[model samples]
Target: MPLYKTLTPNSQTTVKIWKITETYDDLLEPISLKPENMKRVLGMKSELHQRGFLSVRHLLLEFGYTDDDLFYDEYGKPHLKDGKHISITHSFTFSGVVVSDGIVGIDIEKQREKIGVIAHKFMDYEYQYLDQSDDKYINKLIVIWCIKESLYKLFATPGLSFLQNTLVIPFTLEEASTHAWIDYQDKKYRFDTTFFEFEGFTCAYALPS
Candidate 1:
């Protein structure tokens, strides 16, 4: 089990990251999935996605839960049966989950220069502080993208716009954390966001504050 990292953001929240190095059969050997999830995983066309899905089940075990303890809403946000909040994300070789007493979201993304091509799609207020000429431009954009994605998962609203509604407050890479807001339907919600990099991938998470 390559349980790569664990973070206790607070007393009530736990974030666990896994490095996906096991074969599909290896991941399946220790755990049994619920019927629906088994069917869902089997239908996935990509082996990477299958492994990511199975890897999450292992993370659930680390949290003292199981596939039967999780479910998805109409909007496709995952939830715990006991009422605790949970958010999950996986990209390439990394997968992560955040479990908290309050609403929370997590995202992991590989650092890629190609993000610069679509930066305009999701960034506006952040551009004021971002320096494209700097070496950290791609890192900063990945953080922003993860922040917005986490916020979207946290909010779980039907039509929230990453560009128009989500706002990531400025912060340097050294800060490791910042704040963000979501302005939707005349109301605003604030979150305290944190991010970190490991093995060329960045993981960002948000907790409602």
Candidate 2:
């Protein structure tokens, strides 16, 4: 199954989402896995993660690239062989990839009640403006979680607490997009955020300035 969604935030950036339903083998049948990657593949916990890898591989191919077209840095940040910025994400049943010449980050999370329990740990400024009018609080929390996680990925810095370092400017739950910032040291990184509901999941992608 190929679940597809495209986001065009500006003339300079575009994002594509692919939801994969096939088992790991089914998705990897078309691609060649390296010995190192194959070794890592043997450690995957579920078919979900397996397919996630395959789906991202397919994504690279779609972008006119191949497996060898990507490389990971010491921090595990992915960079295109041609020097484009890229980010990858995967959840229980869905996986996503976003690539751009600019800084980019992508995240997918299953909408769940449990995320609410840890909201305070990552939600500081966000708590001030979260609309409480809706009874679906979990949905609201999931949206915030996705946004913060996307920020975390974008920052790629260790020891930055979500609640302490990241802040979301308030918005209605029904809104299609939100804005957020990361204050790390003296530099403030701002992001234009967008979230959408799909297959019991909330997916968020952020581009940095």
**What is candidate 2's CA lDDT for residue 178?**
82
Model 2 lDDT per residue over 56-165, tens place: 88877767778888888877888888878888888876777887878888888898878878888888777776655767778878887888888888778888778888
In model 1, the runs with Cα more than 4 Å from the true position are none
On lDDT, the leading prediction is: 1
lDDT of each candidate versus the true structure: 0.95, 0.80
Write down the lDDT that model 1 would get: 0.95
lDDT of 1 by residue, 105-167 (tens): 999999999999999999899999989899999999999999999999999989999999999
Report the Cα RMSD per candidate.
0.7, 1.7
* TM-score, cand. 1 vs. native: 0.98
- Which residue ranges in model 2 land beyond 4 Å of their true spot? 131-133
- TM-score (C-alpha, index-matched) for candidate 2: 0.92
